[model samples]
Target: GPQGPRHLRPLLDTVLDALHTGTHARGGPLPTGGPDTVTAAVHDAAGDLLPDRGDPDALRTLVHAFAAGAADPAHPLCAAHLHCPPLAVAAAADLAASALNPSLDSWDQAPAASALETLLTRTLARETGHTDGLVTTGGTEANQLALLLARETHGTVRLVHGANAHHSLPRAAWLLGLPDPVVVPAPAGTLDPVALDDALTRLPGPRGSVLVAATAGTTDTGLIDPLPDIAARCTAHGARLHIDAAYGGALLFSDHHRAKLTGLDAAHTITLDLHKLGWQPVPAGLLTVRDAHDLAALHHRTDYLNADDDTEAGLPDLLGRSLRTTRRPDVLKLAVTLKTLGRTGLGALVDQVCAHAREFADLVHDDPRFHLHDRPAISTVLFRPAHAPDPAVAAVRRHLLTTGRAVLGRARADGRLWLKATLLNPATRPDDLRALLTLVHRTHAEGPR
Candidate 1:
């Protein structure tokens, strides 16, 4: 009898090599000069060459290079839009979720994940004074689901949004197979209940079956629509009220901003993005409804999936309520983050970010070069060169990104291109923002010229 030959050499060598490799060095101020080369070097035989395929190490290196060149949201200087660098604890949770690979489609497959998701969704609904909801991939999906549910619940004829509502609202309407949404212009990114009444009044048919949407936080202007008045009108007109609080939902935890979302508790449905204001990892959005049965009309089941008998028995499944399949366990990240940072801490973080936004707005207002759109209600600061002509302002905005200067944003507002900044990081300070603004001005002044 012969013992099997030992083939442990490769494993041992790999472990030893990994140990010797050490860690990545702290590179000097990120090379704003860009990489020396953009193309992948395929000929290098440095490591992991697969005879039939390609060099694995080289492929990995090339991919890393590309990803590194992309925007690093976590960077101290990277503040562009709603996306922010996640907290370290949440990132760790995300890593754990990826490793566990929970699907949440069924209890048998993901019992803990399903339970946790249900609990988290319930908690969120309670926070908004709603009774039912589900986690979504982002604010867009949440808003879409809210509108879809509203359409089914009340048989609404028309969908309406304040002019300043996020683009996602109309996008949601189009996605739900509805006609172009009826948009009423807001005076200053804050929905006017009177304008909404007028829009409903002018509609071709009975406006009783309309869905009027009020934005809790308008993206560019960070303004909250008059939710109480809008709710009252929706009730009087027999219309359904939907609030898109994707950006301002975090303010629920803020004493000062809670009043802005005063009527949210009365809305038929509402959308919120934990990733935006919750400071949780991305893909943590939620849609809540006042009644659980409102979602029954959208209930669907396949023979291979849950049948009516199973659903009647209360078998746990999220597939029928969502548009996605084989979805990631986003709830784990959200729950873990929330558990680590209690509601109070989370609320404080949101308050800090909003305060910073106001501070930045004041700084911009004081500077003759920059202009403020309006006093920021949430964490967004939209501005452009004060008194600069439309073309010049547009050029400055375009140059900021093109020249590798501070990354700001541009939007067509009030018939002009307005450069905007959204404070995504709660840790960001006014001094850091001032530095970013300085970089933006320098680039705008010199780059395009």
Candidate 2:
């Protein structure tokens, strides 16, 4: 059923060409297209498809248009979020994975993919001082799973997290039917151990079950919670600790900044998103648990997929360890990426981004127009133009986005709106960052129009 390479060449070539045209030919990180316009364009493109006919050219054009209109994270000016430009090799591996379409639910469906995922999970676990883990769709799913495991281990418990924790934490609590989390103040954008201890103490009644969730790199300010101190406190209180390192897990690979995540190994569970700092494509989220037996909460028996007898017979299956029955073998691309770029290479990329963030922070500090919130712990710089109101900041962001000049991040922190720039692209240089800052200044000067 496999198509010969000769037969696939033209189609692959068309796709590659379309990608280059869309990404390179596009003037900026994004196109100046409103929702209505983009929606109409998408509708028109969809109309070209027919059940019985396939037009490669039409498909290529549509893909090119879609890509061209996309927010280009590879652009230096696209310092908005944790989105990182994917590595080319990983992208190619993703294509191969798509072609294979391996489902990881069972050994029969995945085979080598399941083995590779198990291997990768083990390797990642060892790196984080764990025994096993699983790949997830992203941080949200990983965090949710971590909470679920915590809930399974410790009954109806209060979830505790920092103010700058990802929005997913509360949502995960809601989904898990756990009470609203205890929100601790993160004045400096990182959790204060004393504040967290006080929060735990203030809890009503004896603390039967408590899951203290910590952030490794908060999305807004890139602050890492004092993991070692928090771990010690959690140990004292017999509370389970979950570190959401979705954005900052790359620090594990960084030779210079790995110490920032000093207590990562001590966490009962940790969430890592490769898409953010690992330079992989999207949906490269991983949840690593310190104890492999803890995964029993997610284990299940299915005669068709993972029967007890089959396991007893030495048959390997991954269904017992996953929430979804049918899932893509995303680990394939991750494996390819890891092999292509060793740990040191990836670490250097992370170091580069962090260094850039520090430099940007210094620049913001020296500039009279902006107020640097705090020294960046990772790759995010949060600051606001002097005397700029929230509306003005919003307008500047909108003006740049609409004009396709830049796409920056906007967040509300410490009772005021602030602009944020996430330096995830290792290729971005100091000049590029300065240019982005200049754009921000120009947009701010334009006022709220």
Candidate 3:
């Protein structure tokens, strides 16, 4: 066990060198020739799935193949999803987390990690005007937990959400065995407060029997709902509110953009994901509760992990913390990132990415070759090649993907398909934006290859 660190040092060098070699081989945002080709290459690199005796070079070989095949979000052209390029410092901390392999399920297994989690979650909860919170796998789990908590509070509460809400919300309702959700119209690409109020009034449920889920940022177009009005409607209707700020929650870090989340504090539970904008690795999500008492719904029991006797004996109860038993000390990387960057540094990155979106939107607006869907509400810009049929637009995105030219997302807004660019990489430059659009325009002009 003591030799673990020494053993890791040289292996890390090989991994880093392999990653660099793979990126060089890739020569673009992602590997060329699409899925089949990438799969074949990976299979070759992997050699045998399992061997009687392991190859010493397996780590370096696999890591190289992994990097080469990955759709690197750090690349300037890889502006597809809410996926973000993680901060270097955060990734470094993640390595240590993996090495120690602390399980948060028991205080004995992860004493310092447990304490760090408690301190971090509480501090982050206060940022959202909450009393306490839980660490989730991501927005999906957070949404599921929010629904779980709501259901526990009010027996079989109906889920009422906007059409703009993420698919996870309705799916979570289904998984929890709740009634089919009532979806209000998002005609303007956001939850229409009036429509939400109407739905709330018409729904046949007791005052506290409805849980209204609203989106702070819609996935397709990145449009934020009118949260203040939605919160007011929830208050008046006596319905509980859970705002999914997975995409826009990081705006809270920015003084300029934090005002956009004026009604965030009103939600009974709030889902905030950092992987999208916090420059952290995947699975960084939190669900904050306005009242710490709400977390009682998740209180769990087990003899080995968090025994009653152990809890009473001043050892912290860890079973009530999560839905999973063997979760990592994910808080470690987050804590490192927050401690290193603080609020202002992280906010500056947010501001820069938002600005990049605006600049890209401008490029699309000024070019007759493309049509800007709308000015970006956050850091997502939607634009389409001018007068291109929806099929052609879809074809253009696929062409770029297959050819490994660029990575861009597609969305349906205003009954038309538009190219979606979610600019989460703050390092992206204006020239890169122009090149991305040029790739789309050129592909559309040349037709699908």
TM-score of each: 0.86, 0.95, 0.99
Candidate order by lDDT, decreasing, is: 3, 2, 1
lDDT of 2 by residue, 112-131 (tens): 99889999999988888889
Q: What is the C-alpha lDDT of each candidate?
A: 0.73, 0.87, 0.93
Q: Model 1, 1-449: lDDT tens per residue?
A: 02211443454354344423311211211223333321222223233444667653543453444343445555445666787768878877886687677886656667788888889888889999999887888788878887788778656557888878888888888877877888887866678789888877776645446888888887776778888898888877778788888888888887777777888998988899878777667778889989898878766677555666776898765666677667778888888878888878888888888888888889898999887777787888878776777787777655554444555666667777787787777777667888877876776676446
Identify the superior model by lDDT, candidate 1 or candidate 3: 3
Instruction: Return model 1's CA RMSD, one decimal.
Output: 5.5
For candidate 2, give the lDDT: 0.87
Q: What is the lDDT of residue 132 in candidate 2?
A: 95
Error of 3 at 60 (Å): 1.3
Model 1 lDDT vs. the true structure? 0.73
Tell me the tens digit of each residue's lDDT in model 3 across 1-449: 79999999998999999999999889999899999999999999998879999898898889989998999999999999999999999999999999999999999999999999999999899999998999988999999999999999888999999888999999999999999999999998998889888998898878779999999888988888999999999999999999999999999999999999999999999999999989999879999999889888879998988889989999998888898999999999999999999999999999999999999999999999999999999999999989889999999999899888899999988899988999999999899998998888888999866
Off by over 4 Å in 1: 1-51, 54-63, 204-208, 308-314
